[model samples]
Target: MSTDAHPTPEGAQSGRGRAPDTEWRSWHARRLETITAPYGPLSLTGTHWLDDHPDGRIPAVPGVWVQDGEEIVLTAAAADGLTHDGELLSGSVRLTAHHGPIPESPLAHGDRRLVVLRREGLRAVRDFDPHAAARSAFQGIEATPYDPRWALPGRFRPYPEQLSVRVRSADGRERGLGLSGEVVFAYDGAERTLRAVVEGDGSLGIVFADATSGDTSYRFRFLRPFAPAADGTVTVDLNRALLPPCAFAGHFICPFPPPGNTLGFAVPAGERRLIGG
Candidate 1:
């Protein structure tokens, strides 16, 4: 997770020689398990930006969260039924900006985790409750089975300097999304490019859309490309493309595709939508 922003996702890796179908099945099953977990994306109920509520009272959430310069002041009285680091918390506590695994977060209300996050100098609190309706009703993600044709080869061209561009988020607010380079490749006899961002682990993150978006698939999806090889050659495997967090929960402010990140053709492979529509 980002100290100043929320992180993306997790997936399983396979050995180089593993059968594609078997590996894909394993990966898909794990993905389902992860999303249905206690604090997974489907369990997220809300992300209340503190700036939206000057009084520090977030809807359906307990605690008074106010931003003070570089920190978030969370005043949870005994009646709030909140805890910090496992002990019942009373009075007020100052919190630093961080968003990661729910268990690692310092604040909680019973089975729900209160994730304090700060992005671009803005603060927010994400509520992750195990009993969220979406998680309980989740059947699985509707993904196309592994198909060799959907996996394409590409080359990573890094920029001389990283740049940040403001893009609209799912929450209807514009936030700066860092773009470090582009992934160029041939798809169906046409050359295409996707804006790429450098992830914390040195991998490339692609948030994009295609013709199928908003019709067959979610509005946008994420493709996590492994760190480039020394020669800059990499595989732009769409078979492993993932549905962004916002697909599971509306509260997630997942960023939309940056300019030029939308593919013109339909991409029928990869995760389409969550089960049960």
Candidate 2:
């Protein structure tokens, strides 16, 4: 592993600080490797909504999939060679939308599973084909190792009223980017805060970019600030920053950074670029 810190003009001022500890740097590197792996977010091929196919059949996916308002009806013959929850499935099953991890999805056929999903009444099916082209073409992710200066202690301040903003996604669609508060921290004596949306589990998500955007790193990156403590203290660890869905497949409707979310500063501390070779 390379412990060296390369200069990034975007966040150059912040990069001049001391890097994080060796153990933390190694952990950050390994995390990047796992996220850029074959089955990582970069490997996602498509997010097919059931509403697009009025006929219960999704293109390229062999199972009969239809959403029946509240539940998804998937019809597959025993010979279709699909699996559900790791077991071979050959019959019709009524499946509800899964809101958990992809690997633990309740529907599958062999290596291909029909994932049922719903967003604001619009139903969709995510096809996780292990043989996806993106998965095969994945070389690795370009990232910066952890630096203590980049992992600043932050405070979560909830808004008096929740804020929602509609932003254009990479797929040319508009989606609501909700914000409940901001996580404020300081780097190089300069205070910075990110507009964050609280998740169902109370975790916070920030869609942001820095000088490295469209230059060294992907256009934009995502950062998840773990749930705040009783005292509202949190750690904004840029080392664990992530690439958005649009970074993997073009089909994803990932929203861009809302106003004020994009820091004018350059963040030169986390995942830096994409290694395609």
TM-score of each: 0.94, 0.81
TM-score of 1: 0.94
Clashing pairs in 2: 10-266, 20-147, 20-148, 82-109, 82-110, 83-108, 83-109, 83-110, 143-271, 143-272
Please, what are the lDDT tens digits per residue for candidate 1 over residues 125-220?
888899999987888889999999977889999999998888898888898888889999998899999988777777788889999999989888
lDDT of 2 by residue, 99-155 (tens): 555567877655654567666677777776667787767666777766666777999
lDDT score of residue 236 within candidate 1: 88
Say which candidate scores most in lDDT.
1
* Predicted structure 2: lDDT: 0.69
Tell me model 1's lDDT, rounded to 2 decimals: 0.83
* Model 2 bad stretches (over 4 Å): 1-20, 36-38, 85-91, 187-191, 200-202
Candidate 1 Cα RMSD after full superposition onto the native fold (Å)? 2.0
